[model samples]
Target: MQAKLRMVDAIIEVHDARVPLTGRNAYFEQNLLADTSKPHILVFNKSDLIDKKYRQPVENEMKSKDKKVHSIMWTDFKHKPMVAAADLIDIVKDSVTNMQRYNRDYRTEYNAMVIGIPNVGKSSLINAVRNRVLGKKGKATRVGDRPGVTMAVLNRITVHENPKIFLIDTPGILAPKAENIENAMKLALCQTVLETTLSESLIADYLLYYLNKRQLFEYVTEFQLKSPTDDIYELLFHIAKSRRLINKSDKDCKPNFSAAANFFIACFRSGRLKSDRFMDFDLLNKS
Candidate 1:
């Protein structure tokens, strides 16, 4: 990433809207931003999944903290047009033009690195901007529901023409160590890391705890539970039985707990469960 940093005119750090405060890679701030101080914008993707009320406050908090960041914008590529995907390119252009582009000041083409910590819609954001600006039909980059989809830093992808803009999509990189187990679980719940990296059951357990802590009990109705419960096993059993994710070959007819856990986590990720559709970070209480 450091090697390619010199080639780009700006930096675009894509992150999960659900976790505005948590699970962000600090390496980028320390190494990339502090060293070079390039024109940067923090794109909070998946804004659709999170509540809209937090937008202004989140933007304010982010801007106040990171003075190097030129702007902070939210984008939900899933629900296009509502949020102008083209705004990204405009922001990049304006920000780059305003700041010192170093050696690339005279260069007409704008190059930026789209980076984040796994599945925060880095590739999807690139595709949205590309399609919006170029009027292209297909994706310019590969994207997936899971994290670590883009395993390497890809070549420059043209997102805009005229005042030419190209984005370098890089793989999501998590910090070598998590600040705490809670933050680690938050990253897992958001699928910043692969499901296999952390056990499905463990992730689901954290999801349940998070929801219950926030008093978001819509999962009970969604899963057809009699009532909201703190017990992760109980919730999984209910989900398994209701969804018929159970083994019938055995006389006992035991529920597939692992499958149940995965389904529960998927429901949370896909915004199937109500209340807090997106797992929001309590920025006020953030450690």
Candidate 2:
């Protein structure tokens, strides 16, 4: 929040579409709604992963609390950047208009800051924006696909001729020190370092439960998994077999079920499962 206050005219909180609620900062909703200084735009990135059915429900929920929400379904490298940049401009324009109407002095000359957890595509979006505006080819410094790729916040030049806008890219936050349930959910959804922080078993269970609830029981039956077990390794082994994940080492033909299990869990968490496995909010509420 301090960084946002110091650097930019408005704050655009980027979140993954696959796990919108999970990818938010614990204090983000509170801080954003409470703050009267500058307006906020919640940019739901990676919308292509989310099922069409769940999108409206989530958006409706957000709009119910705050009417200023705008959503975009982003996919592919060619279009995502352009869409992101355009959306930022629209959001800034709307905020500026409101501020002026109320006789407030919210700065409009500076570009809006794009903030979010790691691997949320802040840099990629920025680069795409710049490419269109500048007519020159240069990459954004902090862009990367792997986890923990961005170690620190960065400031980059915008495409506008007069430096009218700037992009302040922040490092992806780890689990907050405080044990807030909201924070945990956000980290699980947004933070790129999925394997180290969250247990593989937890992710597996989430997938299993989601698939089962959707009446997609083949996922479990195909793998021939036993009932929920405390053993992470055993659960992973079952998942690997079900997914037909096997190791083909020249030295030993043994299936690398352990490695496959980890990969599967990661993919599921990242929304690469190629199926609509929306989180059962009822279960989450119960937990």
Candidate 3:
């Protein structure tokens, strides 16, 4: 990452809107933020997953705490992506226009990099921008639910033509370990880290912890539980039995808790189950 610092004019740091304040890769600060001396826009993608009320608060908190984050905005990649793409362009332009040129002053066109932890809509954002800005029809990068979709540093793809804007997409990378246990759980629960890298049941357990701690009991009814309980096994049993997500499909067979846990985690990550808009802001700061 350090080797390519000279190649771009700005950095677009994408993170999941659900976890706006946590699970940001520490490496970004070391490699990109240090030398770029240019525009750095932190975009919280997947904004549809969280409610709208928390957006300003999240941006404000980040600016107050992390001085490096000069510009912050949110986008939902699933709906009206073109509109989101335009907003992203405006963000980059505003940041770039305001900054004093200490780095690449001779460059006429704009070059930027799309980077963040895994599965945070980096590629999808690129596709949206291409479709919106360039009238292009298809994705330039592969996007998947799991991590490591783009394995290497990719060639620059043209998104805008007037000012000649291009974005380089890179593989998502995380720290060797999280800064703490709570951060680890948040990262795992958000599916930024691979499920195989962490225990699925434990990740689901963390989801439960997050929901219950916030009194976001929507999971109970979503999974057919009569009421909320602290016991993860109880919720898993109900979810498995209700969804019939068991192996050796005999009605009398025991509930497949693992399968149930996996399903629950998927729902959480996909936004089928969501908390208040202020979830991350309230919970992570407390932790």
Task: Give the whole-model CA lDDT for all candidates, comma-separated.
Answer: 0.82, 0.58, 0.80
Writing each residue's lDDT as its tens digit, candidate 1 over 172-283 gives 8889877887888888887787667688999889888888988889898888788889999998888888889987776888999999999998888777886585554575
Ranking by lDDT: 1, 3, 2
lDDT per residue (tens digit) for residues 1-287 in model 3 = 66665777788999998777675776888766865567778989888877787777777677877787767878887787988999998877666656676656787677778889888889999999888888888778898987778799888998877678888899998888987777888777777888787787888888788788888898877876778999999888888888877778766788888899989888876668755533366654563
**Cα-based lDDT at residue 77, candidate 1:** 77
Off by over 4 Å in 1: 81-83, 248-251, 278-280
Candidate 3: where are CA atoms >4 Å away? 97-99, 102-104, 249-252, 277-279, 283-287
Scored by TM-score, the top model is 1
In candidate 2, position 98 carries an lDDT of: 50
Work out the TM-score per prediction. Answer: 0.92, 0.72, 0.90
CA-RMSD of model 3: 2.4
Leading candidate by lDDT: 1
TM-score of predicted structure 3 = 0.90
Give the per-residue lDDT of model 2 (tens digit) for 121-191.
76776677677677668786657766567676665566565536676766665445525543443344334
Candidate 2 residue runs with Cα over 4 Å from true position: 1-4, 29-33, 66-79, 101-108, 174-191, 218-255, 266-273, 280-287
